[model samples]
Target: MTNGFCSDDFAPVKEAFDRNFKELGEVGASVCLTVDGDTKVDLWGGIADPKTGDLWEEDTASIVFSCTKAATALCAHILIDRGALDPAQRVAHYWPEFAKNGKENTTVQMMLNHESAVPAFRDPVRPGGFLDWDYMVARIEDEDAWWEPGTRNGYHMVNFGWTVGELVRRVSGRSLGQFFADEVAGPTGADFWIGVPDNFAKPLAPILPYAAKPGDELSEFSATLLAEPQSLQALSFLNHGGWNMNDPAAHRAEIGGAGGIANARGQVAWYTALATNDGRLVSPEYLATMTRVSVATSRDATLLVPSRFASGFMKSMDNRAHRQGNQASAIIGDSAFGHVGAGGSIGFADPECGLAFSYTMNQMGQGILLNERGQSLIDAAYKVLGFANNRSGAWCR
Candidate 1:
């Protein structure tokens, strides 16, 4: 059921990918890894649509959830590199209306680091409000801060799109989707899209929700969602304006926080550029700054897990020992920085090893972070790279 090219040096990754289907319950998925700007592994298999029994193809793309945040953050960094945006500057400097609701002191870096405290809507979200960019931006403008800005960090959940994305739009004079397409994807030849076009012709795979088994345990975040209906954790994920993720209109909307659509190849291609510093994305010096840890909290307000972030990207977060059974962790190299989707999808660039890696899947996984199916593939890739262990939370050579 699996098909793709794999160099002999990286055959273990192929083994893990195939094992995911045979033993780990992977429905439809693709994984790509590149080292030194060269493709080393590209694999895809299983059913794209279980209902239709359509097999996944090489070009099949699906919504990657929060992985889209990395792309949106990249757009902001591009503007920063061009001197059109400043992280230390007040967000109101770019978007004046954002100064309302005690947010005048919030800086761009605060928003990027999830410390702006406007994590989610406390009031009921209007039906289909997420599909409208202006409505969401206005919601952010009027919403009160959950805590003092820049004091504590919380996972922005869905609002990262408008919070950070608005700065990109105002400074770049282009929408986040348009800026990424023209500046990043188009030049890099990546097949990813923020707002999928109406004429998009690629084989699109609809995400299949995770089916809970009899003995499945819940994480702190999951437990909160069920126990507290009106909590920030609940509002951030459940107050989504009743928009169906499978709807074509949802796919067409530029929900930069979670609406990205791409396959493994497309994600790896984009990361490869960032990893190799090919002079197309950002300068090497700036890229180094972008990948370093910007903020870390022992307990995230929304996710309810230990988390670390670099600007808008996620740094290596290992919660394996934080919780007993249902804990989830993403253990990449110390130099790696990227984002993980709601399910298990992930894309990252490890500049230390000159590596770019991505895993895309149709079947949603249970945990808030990388699940076993995705973590196994990452572990195998690191082993092939001669990493000794991840016992220290992150893979080390």
Candidate 2:
């Protein structure tokens, strides 16, 4: 088929795909774009299989790492809009046991902002720790926090999905994954899926090998923002038995932060719905709240950097790599928000432009976290919208 994007308009996008596939050893990759709520770019190339070199198809779903957190948080925001859960309410109100260990005062907003200090399980996290939903919650219930909740923002690490999911379950009486499907994915008909189901495993492309070597370039980025010098190498996100793509039973696993899997279509749809106020998933008012920066400026205990949190979502306190653009990636617009997966995959929306952009890839870059390829596409989008290199450190609401 002819390239969906105009040749001139798609130059940077095509370049990004080609450079990654060739120079960066990218195996399978896909990118999607919706402008003014219309799909302007839906393109995939490169091989999905390393063994036989099978090409990436239109329906390839890869595990979109932290990008899943946004979807999970979206579930919570849905209920918040419906008045089922209050961000400011004490978490104990929803799940009484959560009040143990001086946590009675912790609010749902605190947990979502990564301010709850439940980064790791405070216990060993193994494969099925994901399955033992109750044990996981119990652990959080009994343990003292690493820091005071709501004092600062930190990456929830492995515990974000569980913490948020548990609160969601108590409020909605459905597992995090189920609530997401019933309230978010199913209604939107987007390709994004959390807690992978058995039947859908066939279409997924397992994560390609990357994080093994630091190759010297990313050492600074690794040390500064990641809280560890060898973070990129020690980052074992791809280690789950089938972290690549999960089967049915695995779909219910509480990976609110990581287990989200999606093709380009799903990512685009999420932003499409988010931008246009497509009902049944998340309302426009709630969507606005999701990016409201619930936590203010401070050094995060886990991420060890300054950040702003919007309930269970993340916003930029400063211009970081993913926040790359004229104004800053995170500060693109008041309504611009989405999340990036661990590897090179990224998805987000800018309602101001009526645009949603996504890029998925198998090859993981050695950069600290954000991939240059994905950022390039976003920069091009900014150029198309006439805000190519903003530095005002402000977002137009």
Candidate 3:
């Protein structure tokens, strides 16, 4: 069921990957890891489409949902590193229209840190509005801030693509997708795409939604999504203009917050540059700023769970004991920074250990964060690196 290579020292990761298929119901997935800028594990297996029984190949790409945020954030940071954008500056300094509706004080950092107070649309989005970049940008510009911009934080969820992505477009004079292609993916040779092109030849894996058992409980965020359709939790995730996530059109649309398409190898390759500080992406100083925790809260407005975020990326967040239904946690090295997708997909750079790790799968998992299948692999990697435990919410030596 599994195929690929694993370094001798990282054999445990391969075992964990296999166990995901045997025990955790992983459908189609790929996991890749790099340490000290060396490829340590690259594996993929299972059926790409259960309906057709097609096999997952070496280059099969799947929608990696919110993991795209890391790529989007990296593009913005590149512009920041080049003096083309400033994080601390008011966002209106670049996109003048964003200042309207109590957002005059919204800084670029606020947008990246999820403190922009525009986490979701209060009104319903028009059909297919998410696919229209201009339409979404205009909507965000015209919408009122939910609260004072800098007072607190909420997971921006889907709107993150447009909010920070617009800044990338305005300041860099290029669309977010193009900027990522030209600057990040192209230079690093990562086979990830913000907007998949028509000629994309690799086999695409269709996502299989998670199925809940009879006794499965709902997370607080899930309960809110069900009970309060107008709440930020629901609006952020459910107000997406009724776009079919698995459709080809959605793949072509550049929804940077949740529409990235890639395999595990592509994510690991991209993160390797950052993990090694290889000078291809950003300076070490800027990388430090990007990885440092920017905001943390016991209860996220959207997710309704403990959360920690860096600028445009997620830090190690252990919510195992914080809730009853979904005890999901993204427990990586303390210094690691990355984003978890809507399901189980994850990608991160642990600079402390010179490791870049990623796991991508077509089968959606039951949680807003890393599920057991993905976390098990992470645990194995950390153990091989001699990390003691994730006792303090993050793995440490």
Instruction: Estimate the TM-score of every prediction.
Output: 0.99, 0.85, 0.98
What are the RMSD figures for all models against the true structure? Answer: 0.9, 4.1, 1.0
lDDT of 1 by residue, 1-397 (tens): 9998999999999999999999989999999999999999999999999999999999999999999999999999998998989999999999999997888899999999999989999998899999999999999999999998999999998899999999999998898899999999998999999998889999989999888889977777888899999999899999999977788999999999999999999999989998888778988778987888999999998888888999999999988876632236888999999999988999999998999999999999888889899999999999999999998889999
> Which stretches of model 3 miss by more than 4 angstroms?
none
lDDT of 3 by residue, 271-361 (tens): 9999998889998777898789999998887788878899999999888786652345888999999999978899999899999999999
Per-candidate Cα lDDT values, in order, are: 0.92, 0.67, 0.91
- The full ranking of all candidates by lDDT, starting with the best, is 1, 3, 2
**How far off is residue 367 in model 2, in Å?**
4.1
Per-residue C-alpha lDDT of model 2 across residues 229-287, encoded as one tens digit per residue: 33322232322333324344545465777778787778888778876665656666656
Model 3 is weakest, by summed lDDT over 10 consecutive residues, at 320-329
Candidate 2 has what TM-score? Answer: 0.85
Better by lDDT, candidate 2 or 1 = 1
